[model samples]
Target: MANRWIRPEVYPLFAAVGVVVGICGMQLVRNICINPDVRVSKEKRSSAVLENSAEGERYAEHALRKFVRNKKPQIMPSVNTFFSDSNRD
Candidate 1:
């Protein structure tokens, strides 16, 4: 009966939405537990601010930038090692 509304063609769309929602859920959970500024207690929630303060600098960085900020683009980690003999072990 339920199969009448559901189709195989819609499976990919469901998978994509599930992935997106899962990523967002994980991010939210991570922020709540790890970020100092994210107040779990009701009393502290009033004082919470979205913008970065002095200490908030660490937590305020966007997810993409936080990872990519210090990371230099490397086509492959072993590319240079493979080409260079002096550095090879």
Candidate 2:
């Protein structure tokens, strides 16, 4: 009689467990490695730049308005002649 190490049915279960464990471990490592100090510094800088200066706020607003205006589609009239003398008094 030959000794079999792994049953065929258990192989898929092991693979599934391995995949779940790997994903969990990767997420744990990423959470641990992320720098909170860098995030805080970036947030402070952004808020300071955006909220501190009136000129900067004006520039940002102007830029945003310009961007929105530029993104709008231009509507051209399909009719060639503007003046249609149909009901002239």
TM-scores for all candidates: the values are 0.51, 0.35
Candidate 1 residue-wise lDDT, 14-56, digit = tens: 9999999999999899888868777888887887465546547
Q: Candidate 1: give its CA RMSD in angstroms.
A: 6.4
lDDT of each: 0.78, 0.56
Off by over 4 Å in 1: 42-57, 60-67, 70-89
Q: What is the model-wide C-alpha lDDT for candidate 2? A: 0.56
Q: Where does candidate 1 clash, by residue pair? A: none
User: Residue-wise lDDT of candidate 2 within 41-74, one digit each (tens)?
Assistant: 5455454333335644553466458776755353
Give me candidate 1's TM-score against the actual structure. Answer: 0.51
